[model samples]
Target chain A: MSNRSHATQERILAAAETLILGRGFSSTGIDEIVDAAAITKSGFFYHYADKNEMARALVKRYLEKDNQVFTDLFARADSLSEDPLQQLLIFLHLFAETMTRMEMTHPGCLVVTFTYERYQADEQVADMVRQGVLTWRQLIAQRLATIAEIYPPRLEVDLEELADMFTTVVEGGILLTRVFDHNKHLGRQVLLYRNFLRMIFSPDPSR
Target chain B: MSNRSHATQERILAAAETLILGRGFSSTGIDEIVDAAAITKSGFFYHYADKNEMARALVKRYLEKDNQVFTDLFARADSLSEDPLQQLLIFLHLFAETMTRMEMTHPGCLVVTFTYERYQADEQVADMVRQGVLTWRQLIAQRLATIAEIYPPRLEVDLEELADMFTTVVEGGILLTRVFDHNKHLGRQVLLYRNFLRMIFSPDPSR
Candidate 1:
């Protein structure tokens, strides 16, 4: 695709995601998305074969965006510290800070939005969302396993569960902050997770 | 209300919630709910004045049911142990075990369901969901405050944030388990929270 077309596709996807996040997939009409994107119907059809294709593209776009963020944060954390445990902790702090930096309650996650309306998507769309979550799990679990090898945790923490706890905290944090309209709760949850990690790994174990 | 009418009402509500959770509020039609409930259109109307009223009623019903379960579990935990920290831990275990007891992936919480589709709901519906989450936060914080008085958390945990962590864990756990079709993750996440609590408290430092 041309750069202009690519940019338009991104704009359309962003509008779709924002609408779907607030309402749902099935209820978010194509015309509404086109209007929001300031694109013509022909422009939308040129980019997506159908609603299913659009949904798939949205999931793909979201996952790639999320993966980029994760990779960037982890890379920055890795450069800052040698210890795998500290690196993971630093990564979470960075991630949480990003949440705190959001001007509004974080837009709810795309994979989570898809998960709730799985019945509306085709098998391909479902697979994209499932893979999106798996990707997150693997990324966190890899760091956690590295930490497990280095620190020998103060608790019998399952690496997978530990990794998932981060995902849960973010997802749950989004829900809490959105529901209560309190943006700080997301940061607090992240810090709470950080506090838990500190208590588990810090040699002195003093706050 | 007559027992028969009450039972039919439950049937309609159950069908509506199940459908709504799978798809979403706007996508789920009244006819689909009636068909699922195995009731006629008149029967559904008899139970609920309209779809809006049904949505309101469902939120009210779900919050009450949830409040009842949380209260019962905490009361049971309090009775089981003298230590406030221990009581809270026990409550999570029971809660996790309860998640395991479900034969299927959780249906998801009604408050959370409404949250994703808040734009579609009336102000009253939105208020109920907001209130529902607040109630959960208050309930969990009350217990954590009790624990704080006794334990003086070593990590300087915010009682409200710590309590919100439980909400996040469960909400996150439900999302993970449901997305993966694995019932165990929910219990495992709960246990992870339990483990975090243990690390935060307990006079013994043993892993």
Candidate 2:
């Protein structure tokens, strides 16, 4: 695609994302997205064969961007600390700070929005969402296994379940902050998860 | 007013909920709801003045049922254990079991579905959602405080934020389980949470 066409497609996806956040994929029509993007009908169809195609493209873009953020943050944390547990702690703390600095209360995630509705319009959208979550689960679970090898928790904890907790806290924290209309608790929840980790790993409880 | 009207009303709400689970409120029309209920338009109007009224009724019914479940489970836990912390652990264990026993991956929650889309359709719907989350937050926080009084954490933990974690894990766990097309993790997430509580409260790290 040419630079102009790429930009138009970007604009169209952006518009759809914004509307989908406020409503849902089914309620949001292609015409509204085209109008919002200042593109003609033919221009919209040129990029996406249909809304289902758009859903696929949007999830792909969102996951790529999300994975990049996680990779960068984890890599930076790893550089700062030799201990896997400490690295996770630092990563979560930094992650919370990033969310706290957001201008809005984390304008809902596309993966979450689509998953909650479980939209029948696109099976591919749901597949991508499941894939995105599993990717996060895998990412967090790998670090947790490293931590468990070095310092096993007093309680028998499942490494995979522990990993899913990170995803849970984030998605759940986003809901709480959004519903309560505060950007505050997403980071707080991350810290709480961090605290749980520290309690499990740190040698001393009172410390 | 009559039994027949009450049954019809329930049928309509149930239909609306079923549809909304698969989509959003805006995408679910009253006509469709009445059609699903096999009720005439006049019968639908008699029960609900408008879609706004239906939204209100749906939320009211949903919250009452949700709260009752919490109350009953907590009561059972309290009866089973004298210790507050033990009671919470038991309640969470039972809750997880309840979720695990679900025939299918837990259906999508209304509050979560609506909150994700950040629906612009009704302010009242949003308010009810916010209220429902707060109710759960308050419910969990009260139990956590009881646990804290007897067993404070090693780290400085915020009770309110900790309470929200229950809500977060649950809502998040449901999403994970649903997205993965498995009804497995919701309960496991609860157990992981229980382990976190155990780690925090027990004096010995190696215990």
Q: What is the two-chain DockQ of model 2?
A: 0.69
Task: Give lDDT tens digits, candidate 2, residues A100-188.
Answer: 77517336777877877655657888888888888988888888888888988746667777788999999888777778767887889
Candidate 1 per-residue lDDT, tens place, B1-207, comes to 499988888898889988888777877889999999998998888777788898988899988988898889989998999988889889989988887775265456667667766535478898898888788878878877777777767677667777889888888887777677667877889898888777666666574
Task: TM-score for candidate 1, please give it.
Answer: 0.93
Could you tell me how far off, in angstroms, the CA of residue B90 lies in candidate 1 after the best superposition? 1.7
DockQ per candidate: 0.64, 0.69
- What is candidate 1's lDDT per residue for A1-207, written digit by digit as tens? 489988999899989988888777877889999999999988999999998899998889888988998899999999999988788889889988886786264467777667766545478888888788888889888877766676777777777777788888888887777677658888789888887876766666764
Top candidate, metric DockQ: 2
